[model samples]
Target: MITGPLCRAARALTELSREKLAALSGVDEHVIELFERRIAAPDANVVAMLKSTLEDMGAVFIPEDRRGAGVRLKFTASETKRIATLESEGGLIRGDDVP
Candidate 1:
């Protein structure tokens, strides 16, 4: 059985070279690279953006706290609203029609 690549949380989120992810996420390239290489870990908000961006790419995040215990998905109520607002602003989902 061949196991798929299991990247670190940061790597999984960026899914691109540090330089590219930096441009896409509007974060510093060095900082993103450091996080992926385990030299640093981003703060909660940065991580949350990375996670949400990855979701659009069909990638899922499993918190390290819940690793190795089967599928682990963390859902934050606030994050959902943030995503909704973001989508509304981007016009991907219409919020005006609902409320």
Candidate 2:
């Protein structure tokens, strides 16, 4: 289960507004606001819906552990491909000269 803080953080990372999230998740904007503000708790199903929608938009939810739960953005397919291509480019490794 995700916490209210996680939800808010995920939304920020995904650059999604409450209205936009509500529309995408089919949840009420007021419910999302209240939930994020820690004012009210919505149904479990509603929370799941929000989580799924955010994930689809690139928000990756980190499970709770010793360091605590968090949220991050997943790299898009194009980004992954570009990174792989760059990694496959064999070149001499050199240290940067800084003084």
Candidate 3:
């Protein structure tokens, strides 16, 4: 179940404005605003649509557990592949100094 905060966090993680999200999800912009503000509650179907839209835009909703619910941006396929290749290079590891 997605909560108001979770939806807002996911939207932020995905860098989507309410207008954009509503356009993509076929949800009303006002409804999104109300939901995020915790001023109103949409039906389960609306929540599902929002979640699906966010997920499609790379927002991954973390299930609630000991750490609690959260949202994160998922890496795209190319990024994942590049990361795997870089890791498999197996070169010497060193820490860089930050100034």
What are the Cα lDDT values of the candidates?
A: 0.52, 0.92, 0.93
Better of 1 and 2 by lDDT: 2
Per-residue CA lDDT of model 1 for 9-48, tens digit only, reads 4344445555665676677777666665666777877766
lDDT of 3 by residue, 1-99 (tens): 798899999999889999999999999999999999999999999999999999999999989999898889999999999999989898877799777
Stretches > 4 Å off in candidate 2: 90-99
Candidate 3 local Cα displacement, residue 10, angstroms = 0.7
Instruction: Specify the highest-lDDT model's number.
Output: 3
Better of 1 and 3 by TM-score: 3
TM-score of 2: 0.86
TM-score, cand. 1 vs. native? 0.46
Ranking by lDDT: 3, 2, 1
After superposition, candidate 3 runs with Cα above 4 Å error: 90-99
Prediction 2 global C-alpha lDDT? 0.92
Backbone clashes (count) for model 1: 0
Q: Identify the candidate with maximal TM-score.
A: 2
